[model samples]
Target: MTPTHAARLVRELSQPLVSGAFLAARDRERLLEVLPSATGETLDAFAAAAVAVRRARIGDAASLCAIVSAKSGRCGENCAFCAQSGHYATNAPQHPLLPPERIVAAAAAMARRGVTRFGVVASGKALPDAELESVATALAGIAALPMAADASLGVLSEDALARLKAAGLAAYHHNLETSRAFYPSICTSRTFEDNLEVLRACRRSGIPVCSGGLFGMGETWADRADLALTLLEAGVFSVPVNFLSPIAGTPLANRPVLSRDEARRIVVLLRFLLPDRHIRICGGRPTVFGRDASLAPMAAGADGLMVGDYLTTSGGMPDADRQGLRRLGFVVAQAG
Candidate 1:
């Protein structure tokens, strides 16, 4: 697409949202058609449009979140970018599920730093019945903090979800990781449909869903757009966008990290497609942008962040992140 054509397309997309109308599905398809070739001035136009849409839709109240890797390592799946996958022999931490107190203690620390959502993430295909009880206990403690207690405990049955929900589970996170077409290339143990069912269960159970994908895994722009569209179709309320950090000993160990411009454009693209959803920058923020420019995605259009240590990588310091977001003119999302 020509620069002028891309500019006009972005303007057209924004004008509808400006006038309080939703973007047409056909226009989103048109944006996808030009997204692969978007660069230079076209990328700039996309970011500007994304910022406008984000401001109009969600304002400047930036959301902050953190996660506790409650149960780590020995993952049954072989996702290519994960360090904790049992299929790979990396140096990621491994442990049984932590006690409820430890999980709540971690959540409390982050909550004190202004994190309003705390997720309990595990590494297995699904939380075993025994671990579920422990996590349920943790959920109650975290909920007592009056924070949103989320979980990413793989594919769970609807019964399991109901149990957690009763224990105060506020949302469930299960990343599709990539597009359906490209999903098999990264993971053979599970299908894209398997992940979608988890989201479906969340919807059926009346629990909010937080789902998105990991970019920079040698996928095409088409794959990225497909994942975003799938998340939208699934009706996920929050989209946690993760760039690949490329762990050693995994299949994608040698894959290059996404360029800063490309990463920012990915955020901008999601903000456009998911105009009303919480477009949160998660796991790969520090890996892709480092500390100095860690907040770049926020400037590009993301309004939520997963602060503090990631599952297997260093993350932005919670206090520092709060200060940084304030400097960027964002009011950190307050506690409930």
Candidate 2:
């Protein structure tokens, strides 16, 4: 594509987004088709266009959120990138669910650091009835902290999600991990439909949904675009973009980490596609960019971040994340 063509396409696609409108279906399809061919200065133009939309639609404040692995390890699913799967023998921690008070205490510490959202995450196909009750109790305490109470407890029914909602659950997270066409290669224990069903249940229960994909697991640009479109179709409120960390003993242990440019491109693509959603940089930020450059995603169009430790990996300290975001000319959202 010529420079003129690339510039025109970027403007055509980004103008609607900057004005708080969506592109027509054909124009959106054209964006997915054209972006893969964008290179050199052309790609830079697309990135800049994404930044414009982000600034206009989402503003300059970067949101900070944290998650606790309330229950770790012993997962039955065989997602190839996870360290907490029972199919792997990695050194990830394993334990039953933590008590409600302990979970609330973790949130309290993060809240003090200005994190406005706290997720109670567990590693399992689905939490048992008893464990769900415990998580519900924890959700109540977390809600009292005046922070958003979120969870990623895997596939759950509408009734179960409504129970948590009544207990003050604010959002439900269940990542699609990747696109439907590429999903079977990454996981076989569960179908792609299962992931969608959980997100749908979240919507039916009136809980906001946080769903996204993991990049750098050998997916194509088309796969990334498809995942973005899927999240849009699912009507998720938040899209937590995670790159593959390639944990040891898992099937993807040997996969190479995505380069900084490629990771930025992923964020830019998601920002353009889901301009109005919360595109939060989550797991694999440190793995892909390291601490010193952790704010690169924000510069690329992301408006939110998952600060502190992740499920099975250490992450950038909250203080550093706050400082880095400030250096990037973005205001950090504080707990209200």
Candidate 3:
């Protein structure tokens, strides 16, 4: 499309979004055209429209969630992009399941920094049976913290979910990672069905699920849209959109970083797709957007921010996140 045509398309198509009505079949078709352009004035216009949609649907406040790497490394999964997968010689030192005191301390730290929803995420296909008691003990401590608690302890059994929910866990996080069609290329140790069942189990156990996927993994745009549609169908409330943060010694280590505009467009696309849901810009925000990433995300239709470090990597500091939120005229929503 010509630049003029692109401009008209964005201006005309983005109008219905301001009413907070979801994209109709035709709107989705037009946005599929508007979102994939790697370079354009249209993308900026689309992003602004997305932000308007975000404000109208979810309001201007950003929800914050902090995560602790409660357990790390020695994951049996062969997710090629992960630093903690045991399939690669990444030199990631294994850390045992943290004691309750340390787990509580991390929650408290982020709570003090104005965070409300905190998660304890470990690396593995599932928590070891031997570690469940310790993890339960940690959840007890996390429960007492002045924040909401969530956990991602791998493909947890119902018993484990019960244990966690009893100990004050209100949410469960298990990323679908990508489209089911793209799952084989991302990991062989686990199927997309495996994760889906686990998420279903969490919901059955009465815990809300926070599921999302990584982008920039050499997948097609169709893969990205398919993943989003799947998550929406699954009733996932929180969509933590993670960009691939490649680690050295991992299979995808040398993968090129995604363009900042593409990253922003992904956020815009998701906001357009899931207008009322939490479209969180998680983990790799710093890697994909080196400067102005914090505000860029909020400006471009994201209302959820994962503050603090990630499971195997550092992220934008909590203080910086706070400043950016304030600069962009966002108030931190109180954590439930």
What TM-score would every model get versus the actual structure? Answer: 0.95, 0.95, 0.94
Better of 2 and 3 by lDDT: 2
Ranking by lDDT: 2, 1, 3
Q: Give the candidate number with the greatest lDDT.
A: 2
lDDT by residue (tens digit), candidate 2, 89-113: 8999999999999999999999899
Cα misplacement distance, residue 270 of candidate 1 (Å): 0.6
Where is model 1 poorest over a 10-residue stretch in terms of lDDT? 15-24
- Stretches of candidate 2 exceeding 4 Å from the true structure: 2-5, 37-40
What's the CA RMSD for each of the models?
A: 1.8, 1.7, 2.0
Q: lDDT values of the candidates?
A: 0.88, 0.90, 0.84
Q: Higher-TM-score candidate among 1 and 3?
A: 1
Q: Between candidates 1 and 2, which one is better according to lDDT?
A: 2
The digit string of per-residue lDDT tens for model 1 on 193-289 reads 9999999999999999999889999988778878988898999999999999988899899999998888988898788778888999998899889
